[model samples]
Target: MGQDAFMEPFSNLFCDLQCKIYFLLVGVCSALKLTVPPHTIHGIEGQPLHLTVNYNFNTTASEVQIIWLFERPQTNPKYLLGSVNQTVVPDLEYQHKFTLIPPNASLMINPLHISDEGNYIVKVNVRGNGTIAASQKIQVAVDVPVTKPIVHTEPSSGVVEYVGNMTLKCTVGKGTRVVYQWMKNGKRLHAGPNYTFSSNNATLLILPVVKEDIGNYSCLVSNPVSAMESEIIVPTIYYGPYGLRVKSDKGLKIGAVFTVDIGEAILFDCSADSNPPNTYSWIQRADNTTHVIKYGPHLEVLSDKVAQKTIDYMCRAFNNVTGKRDETHFTVIVTSVGLEKLAQKGKSLSSLAVITGISLLLILVMAFLFLWKRYQPYKVIQQKLQSRPETDYRKAQTFAGHESASDDFGIYEFVAIPDLAGGSRVSSQSVPGSDFISGQDMLSTVYEVIQHIPAQQQQDHQQ
Candidate 1:
């Protein structure tokens, strides 16, 4: 039983090893599929290049034959390099340039140049279990790197729109198999009525430079290996002072007439669509004549300063480069909400008020003086005399006459004269038949005035 047990383990070990070998064969068979990825390759000039292939076989091969061929359009395949088993055979012409490794089919080209660009064919034949064949073709391209290009314009000076011709040329520093394309304002440009191109599309000719041709232009240069673009340039073209008009900052503008308040200031701006900015001049027209009022793009008009309330004005815009000028005429109207008139009226009222105030003050002063003169001078004396006892009554006699009181109130005049020696003299004058009291009668009446009663009582006392 012990001997059988030892032999059983060894038998099982042998069975497992056979099974592993069976799976290994199956994996090797699956790997036999040949693969050649990226059948096309690009290479730079004066640079080394490579092309590769992959293949496998389940069992060891007695002989492996690899052959490489070169072909172009409408041409038979030409031999390049090959290997059989372990020996390498290369064409004498390209032996030093192209390298071929056996079993692993990969090619290397030293110092690739522009002339080595074409289709390449690689074939590998496996001799195990019958002759098995596999082949792949790869396309190769060689190119010199593109350099920065420059653009030159004919007639670099300013060209008038629709009158002059212009041409643009693109040149590269160094490149191989380069193609050129034109771009305007960041978009691809094509031939049109005014645009023509050279044979290689490297030069662009504009028969007539229009206003639309004034834009940014550039050239795009490209090759299989690299691409480059030229610097953007803007061509000069002179345009007109088009779409000219006038606008104001402050006013009621209808069509061309501007209405402004009497004392208001308004600013007028003149503008136009032009290549070069226009120089503006403001002109005032009066009595069928015109004169320049200001010289600038902006004009400030004060309504009060202008003599004519309603006037005609013009704004002229001239382009120095294009030699073109445009003029627009407008009427400026002054409307009366009567603010200025109201101000004048207010001034008159103020003057009249001042005069009336002065007159009133003078009249009041004169009235006060008249009242004081007529009564104030006698009141103090009368009061003092009345304060005394009746002892003065015999000296003062009272007269109760109605006609005496009526005759005392009247207008009196005073005159000033120069004396004979230039001394000043003042005299009082009263007409003889005037309704006024005489000096002596005034004294007597004043003495009796303190004892005044009613008029009827005075009349009765007289009777």
Candidate 2:
């Protein structure tokens, strides 16, 4: 309880200290204060300008005074105007230009000029219990509005690429404290190896102009009050004939070689990328000699009319203005591929006809073979067997004559058996020699030999 009592006095002291600090802040908030919304402002020449100020004070004032003063850099301040309650007073030198009202603390200047640009001070004073004074400062800038800019190029006739120089100058009719900038194709441009600018950026110079330097250019001029851009200007530059090439309407191209069908008429076009369009010439090389054949961009060649099967051709592009030239070479070959294609079509049809004819012949041969195999062989064998008996009987009769005794000299065996019922005697006896044989016996023996021949032997003999 004693400790708590001791701490209560310290708490009261802390609260009293907080109350004093709060009251001090309240006194500061109620003091006379002056404020200018913008610390700096820009104005155009020959225009009206206003310096606004706000002020408030808690003390009751019997009189209120507002005074305005102007000062330049490193110069003493000069009185411009003042107001007491509702009455206004201005300096005799600037009485008609400066205006003010009492308790307003604001000042106005009509017909602002470049010489009138400076710092302005507004002071507000209240007098009753004591004088409460507050002041604020404002910076003013005056500029002449920029007019439309004009750009002029040197040697407007034109320039040759890589052989000429160019210059561009920017000008404004009426402007003060102005700045200049250069634009190319609507984008800001900077210094480059080939491009330079004047100290004020009002002039641009191109050293040894090139093809890349050709573009739309403009100049932009501005001041604190106004800004303007000049009309777009394009500089003419003459360049060479580039990327020379040749193209044909009907041909098979491989690199620089063109293969055209025989008897075909092909049209070739020579072209190049150039500024002023190029003049073309066609040259043909044959038999170790070259000569210009045509003087235009197009040439028609008949494959059959060309003397040589393979030929060399050239397309020359010339730029008259720049005195530059470029050329490309190509080869043309006359071929029979189209005729061969037609022949191949005919051969394919002929081959199909031949194959069909051969197939029909093979079918006929197979049918003939089937007929021969089924009926012809049997008739032929029957005819041959029917004639076999007559042929063998005649052969046996001839052998019986023994025209050459040497042929019948070999040893022989003969057997005879009689038929019991027919009364024919069978002889199991050896025959006499050829010299002693009888005619009847010979005849019978021959008949017997013919009857004894094997059936297989007769078939073999017939075959």
Candidate 3:
């Protein structure tokens, strides 16, 4: 009872001091103002942080003093540091952890750890004839940064399509206040009919697995200070044999039929979209009977090797896990039409070449005839002259009465011949001094001149 009675007065005195400080803080707002921007701040562990206090006073500050205090949950405020007239005095135990620059009551905490998270208080008092006081408060938080995350998948071996459930989890070694995001095939995953997320998205659940759910998955974790991403994880899911089809490299394919040249080799490819890839089988229909001829994704068919001219083929795909199957039907039609068409084309080309050659020959002949007819008369005359023997000419003189005037040079007389009953009268061609001369005389003169030249050439040869 005595101890309780003694503490009552001290409690009342504390209440009185608190009331005065509260009134003083309210009163100084008009004359002096205090401010702390960002009343709350978050910091990373092992990093530095700063808490600022801004103030302004209407009157001149003769002497200024600043005090800093630290408080936590359900605990009395403790003194950390103070400044007077541009000088700082900090607690010895925390001298290295806290800093104070006087006149501007901002605090700096270096190498901040988790223990530094708390509320901090600052008080400013100016002393002179008239004094005013102001104060500001700031809350600080420290956290450990997030690290690289890793993803883990349940039933890692595999899962059957439409009959199994899958779960994905994200794990990290070191972090505080971490968040998680799920991703598949580089796209953000969303909660849907087939998917559900845990509280923080650290875990993803797939109700029932399907082919659509099979993909590379990852996780991203983040916090205020740091972020991290997980490695990729691929979940195996067995599915069906879908979109089955047959393909060939060398053929004219239309509908399900392929037309290949006779004696040519054709390769057929069978495929489908399935997990644990589909087992392929080739079927041949011959003589109204079907038989499985081969087992593979590829088949080689030789047109001439098969007995039938037109044969039907089938490609079947089976999924061993899903127990589903699919098939495609196609016909391999063997024909010699490719070769026959080529032969006909060759014949047509040969005939066309022959006709072209004949037409060219005719054109050349016509051009030659046109040139010959244009100069026919000149050509005939030249040929006649060229065919004559130059040595056969007899040296004889003809009448040249036209060379001078008729009075100066006597003109030649042209005598007309008269017809008779028994014989024909002769006309005379002779050189005339004044009148015509006898033909017999002119003829003998020319003959004698011609005979004399040969006789002179023979005598020279004999000498």
Q: lDDT per prediction?
A: 0.75, 0.77, 0.75
Better of 1 and 2 by TM-score: 2
TM-score of each: 0.60, 0.66, 0.67
Q: Rank the candidate models, highest TM-score first.
A: 3, 2, 1
Choose the strongest candidate by lDDT. 2
Q: List ranges where model 3 is wrong by over 4 Å.
A: 1-29, 339-463
Q: What is the clash count for each candidate, in the order shown?
A: 0, 2, 0
Cα lDDT tens digits for candidate 3, 321-360? 8899999999988898784435533544577888999999
The residue pairs that clash in candidate 1, if any, are none
What TM-score does candidate 1 reach? Answer: 0.60
Q: List the residue pairs that clash in candidate 3.
A: none
Q: What is model 3's C-alpha RMSD?
A: 15.0
